[model samples]
Target: MSSSDIFIGEIIGTAVLILLGGGVVAAVVLKRSKAQNAGWLAITFGWGFAVLTAVYMTGSLSGAHLNPAVTLGIAIKDGEWGNVPVYFAGQLLGAMIGAALVWVAYYGQFHAHLTDREIVGDPADKAIEGPHDTKNTAGPVLGVFSTGPEIRNVWQNLATEILGTLVLVLAVLTQGLNDSGKGLGVVGGLMVAFVVVSVGLSLGGPTGYAINPARDLGPRIVHALLPLPNKGGSDWGYAWIPVVGPLIGGALAAGIYNIAFA
Candidate 1:
């Protein structure tokens, strides 16, 4: 694919991925949305369908490598790094746009959730600050945009992300094996969606299963920039784990694929 094609496809596909994926979170978490309190199963399935839609829409253009981790894994497997930056750029841009769109789509819900603290408690009030006490300061509603560890153990959190992303990239790497032992058709895309859903169900608890760097970071940037009430802290301290872990995981998966499969 041409650079333009790759860039456009990644941007569009990833944007759609985040829009629908994040939309589900906002719906489930926000105060008055119909889907509020829909639970984790809903979220996992929502994300799976988001991936399904995005992949189908952009598969022809850039093979729908909407996630940076997937792009990195593919690049590592192929031993060609030329288009990696382009893929990253496009994915990040798409993530941001998708996050913004989510905000727009749930504008009323966001306002409702933030304005009525009694009805919809502030997330930062429960944010961990000290060993025993929580902080009173307002924090950003970052969960809808990014991932956070349920238990704040650095090593454990990092390990969870590494393992989760490892599963994701590994599945992506070995998506569809034809007679030639390469290539993923439509079946592969659908399989990837299920793998994502499986990873979420099995591994999402640790750090919300941020298997893709762009999936987490792009929306994070938007959360920081957007003008939302009581948006709270972006939790930059915990941000690195999602980014670093997924990159490491992708590399590890690629390395494993090259060693065992290729």
Candidate 2:
């Protein structure tokens, strides 16, 4: 594929990924919806299917590294460094557009439902009265954009994200695209899906297993800009962990793969 074709394919592939992966979250979390609170199993399957479809469509042209961390990992494994910026930018931009589409797809429901202020029982008090109360106002918006643990703290949350993403990237490096005697093909996509499921089942309760910076940050930005009944703060406090954790995990996985093979 030409450079332009690869770039366009990456954008389209990432958009499809976020549309399905992130869209499922919006479906389950937003109020009065069909899939509300459906639990981790549903999310795991949704993401798995999303990745499966994306890979089938664009894996040949762009390798379908929808996550920036995955792209970085591939770059470490002999992928051209010059294409790094193009792929990363395409993924992020596609994620943002996909997230915006999700919001648009669910706009009617978001606007018709109760606002965050009302959910917090302040209806009158726009300011969050307490941390616990903050959830009532923030839950709907943040819930759709990213995952937060039931327990809140920076270090623990960060640890969960790092550990989860490390497991995910490690799986990707070893089982995803290697020159094993058994070669990777259709099963590789299935393996990727299973990795996401494992993360969701085990560590998803904490930090919502964002693992992908574009997945969280792109949607969060949309949640801030879009008109909803009641939106809360962007929850920037824990944003760094999702970004840093996945990058670290991807790099760690690549390093481990290099060492094990060498």
TM-scores for all predictions: 0.92, 0.86
lDDT tens digits by residue: candidate 2, 27-110: 776667788889768887888788788767777666677787777776776645777787778788877788888777877657
Worst 10 residues of 1 by lDDT: 128-137
lDDT of 1 by residue, 1-262 (tens): 7889989999999999999999999889887799989999999999999998998898877778888888888888887888889899999999999999999999998888777857334444555232343432333257889988778999998988888888888887887422332223488889989998999999998778988899999998998899987666677778898999999998999999999988
TM-score top scorer: 1
Assess each prediction's global lDDT (C-alpha) against the native.
Answer: 0.83, 0.71
Task: Tell me the lDDT of candidate 1.
Answer: 0.83
